[model samples]
Structures are given as structure tokens and as C-alpha cells.
Target: MRTFAVLNQKGGVGKTTTAINLAHAMALRGHLVTAIDMDPQNHLTAGLGQETHPQVGIDEVLLAESDLQTTVIDARQNLQLVPAGTRLSEVEQGARGVKGGLLLANEIKKLERQDFVFIDCPPSSGILSMNAILAANEIIVPVSSDYLALHGMSRLMGILNHVEKRLHHKMTVWVALTRFHGRRRLANEVRDKLVNYFPGSVLKTPIREAVALAESPSYGQTIFEYQKRGNGSNDYSALADDLLHGRTR
Candidate 1:
């Protein structure tokens, strides 16, 4: 499986949103996709229309209390989900030592028949986030069009560098510009800076700021299900195509 961790150190940067929609988008294309909610908040679980407080979830897998396969639940036709159970917050305190960080990575290696696995990481750079980073072969950083988001991106880059050195494992990183506004000068400026700094790592399709993108989560639906013809749906579809075709560096 081509595993990806949808990660961002800063909250409200479309990390969960991108994970939910992007996974579904790939599943829509007939690929078997599994989305793991590594965030304790359970946003990805709820957003996928699944019960927020599942008894068995990624937390159990990380804690070694349950196997990953047993916790898997169907979310969509081709999309499967591993919810972030209510006790997920305890993982940081419960699972200590170096072994804690490698739990998710070990569990992921045992997975079978999944074409894509997207892990939705927590906003903070905690043990949970570390597990996601270590498990995935690729990292998708969602950069919203704002100065604060740009600052967050810089912080995340530093964390990534540190992890790569400490763990001696390198991951392919891609930047997805989210909530972009073509009409706004600030948004355009942010895009320019990202393209300049990231070069080919920045994804070509920018997810435009759209009502459908924001509203879909509330209704427990992906953009395609909520508004298929909307900009949100179109952008995410293009994004799936981009990743599938190796359009990014």
C-alpha cells in the first residue's frame, strides 16, 4: 500500500478535511483506501459519517490492545476507516518509551490488500503524530492560504527534518494548498511563496475556499457526495489524480 500521513502541526489547516475527502476521492476511483484517524479529536471518524467514539480504533492498535484488522470498519463503498476511539488521548501517557513511537508503524506493516492508506494526524507534534509520521511513506502537508498557516508550515518542516535524522527514515513530502482564493492578493502571495520554497513538491491543484468543502463535514459527507459539481469536489478529484499519477516530486 502507498501509505500517506495527512499531517499539520497547526490546527484548522485542512488536515482532517483533506484526509477525509482525499481518501474518499481515491476510493471513488475504484482504489481500496483505508483512512486512519490518528487525531484524538476523532474529526476524521465523525467526518466520514462513522461513530466518533468507536470501541475499537487506531488507539487500540497503537496501544497494542487490539489488532489493526479487527478495528477496521467500512466507511464507504471502497473506503475503510479506523476511528480514533475515545481513549485515544491516553496513548501519549500510556504508551511511553521508544517502543510507543513504532507501534503504528508495526501495525501498518501487517495490513493487507489496501491500495492506499491515509493517516489523519493530530495538530500537535505529540506521540500520536509521531506514530503517524513514522508509519507512512509519504506526508501530505495541507497549507491554508494565510500567514499563520505559512508559519505553521515552517515549524512542520523543521519537525520533519528532525524526525528524518532521528529515525533515519526519509519520507516523500508533498504540500497541498488548501482554502486558496484566486481573487485575493494575500492568497496569491502565499501560493507564490510555497511554489518558490517547495517547487515541485507543491501540488498543482489548489483546493479553493468553497462552502461545500466546509459544509460537507457537518453533514457527514465528502465534497463529491455533498456537491459533486462544486469546486471542492473538482479540486479534490484532481488532487487524487495528481498523487495517483506521480505528478508531485
Candidate 2:
């Protein structure tokens, strides 16, 4: 499986939204996708219309209490989900050290048949995020079109660099602009800066600010299901295409 960690140290950057929609978009294309909610907030679980507090979830898998296969729940036709259980917050306290960091990586080995696995990582760089980083072969950081959001990139890059150097595990990192407003000067400036900084690492599609993108999660549906012709759906579909075809630029 091509494992991806949809991560961002700073919150509200459409991280979970990207994870939910991107995974579903790939599933729409007939690829078997499994999305794991590694965030303790359970946004990904609730966004996908799954039970927020599952008996077994990613927390259980990381805790070694349950296996991935048994914890998997059907969220969409070809998109399966592993909900973030109630005790997910306790994982940081429960699982410590390097062994804890590798838990998700070890569990991911069981999903050899899956076409894609997207992990919705937490906002903080805690044990949960560490596990996601260690497990994923690719890292997708959603950079919202705002000054504060863009400012956090340096710190996030530092963390990624430290992880790569310390663990000697290199991952293909991609930056995706989210909540972008093409007409706005600030948003356009942010896009220009990102493209200049990341070069070919930046994705071609920028997820534009849209009501449908925000409203879909409340209805327990993706943008494609909520409003197929909307900008949100179009942007995500293009994003799926970009990733599928390795067209980052």
C-alpha cells in the first residue's frame, strides 16, 4: 500500500478535510483506500459519519489491544476507516519511547492488499504524530492560505528534518494549499511563496475556500457526495489526479 500521513503541526489547516476527501476521492476512482484517524479529536471519524467512539480503533491498534483488520470499519464504498477511539488521548501517556513510535508502522504491515492508506494525524508533534510520521512513506502537509498558517511551516519543516535525520527514514513530502482564495492578494501571495519555497514539492491543485467543503462534514459526506459540481469537489478530484499521476509542481 502507498501510505500517506496527512499531517500538520498547526490545526485548522484542512488536514482532516484533506484526508477524508482525498482518500474518498481515490476510492471513487476504484482504489481500495483505508483512512486511519490518528488524531485524538476524532474529527476524521465524525467527518466520515462513522461512530466517534468505536470499541476498537487506531488507538487500540497502537496500544496493541486490537489488530488493524478487526478495527477497520467501512466508511464509504471503497474507503475503509479506523476510527479514533475514546482513549486515544491516553496513548501518549501509555505508549512511550521508540517502540511506541513504531507501533503504527508495525500495524501497517498487515494492510499489504490496500491500494492506499491515509493517516489523519494530530495537530501536535506528540507520540501519535510521531507514529504517523514513522509509518508513512509520504507526508502531505495542508498549508492554509493565511499568514499564521504559513508561518508555522518553518517549525514543521524543522520537525520533519529532525525526524528524517534521527530515524534515517526519508519520506516524499508534498505541500498542498488549502482554503485558498484566488482573488485575494494575501492568498495569492501565500501561494507564490509556497511555490517558490517548495518548488516541485507543491501540488498543482489548491483547495479553494468553499461552503460545500465545510458543510459536507456536518452531513457526514464528502464534497463529491454533497455537491459534485462545486469547486471543493473539483479541487479535490484534481488533487487525487495529481497524486495518482505523481504530478506535483
The TM-score values for the models, in the order shown, are 0.96, 0.97
Per-residue lDDT of 57 in model 1 = 85
Model 2, 67-104: lDDT tens digits are: 89999898899999999988888888888988889999
lDDT of 1 by residue, 1-249 (tens): 899999998777788999999999999999999999998888898898897444598887777789999999988999999999878888987877667888899999988999999999988888898888889999999999999988888889999999899889799999998988999999999989988888888888899999888888988898999998979999999999888876763
Residue 82 CA error for candidate 1 (Å)?
A: 0.4
Error of 1 at 151 (Å): 1.3
Error of 1 at 226 (Å): 0.8
lDDT of each: 0.89, 0.90
TM-score of model 1 vs. true structure: 0.96
Candidate 2: where are CA atoms >4 Å away? 52-54
RMSD of 1: 1.4
Q: How large is the C-alpha RMSD of every model relative to the true structure?
A: 1.4, 1.2
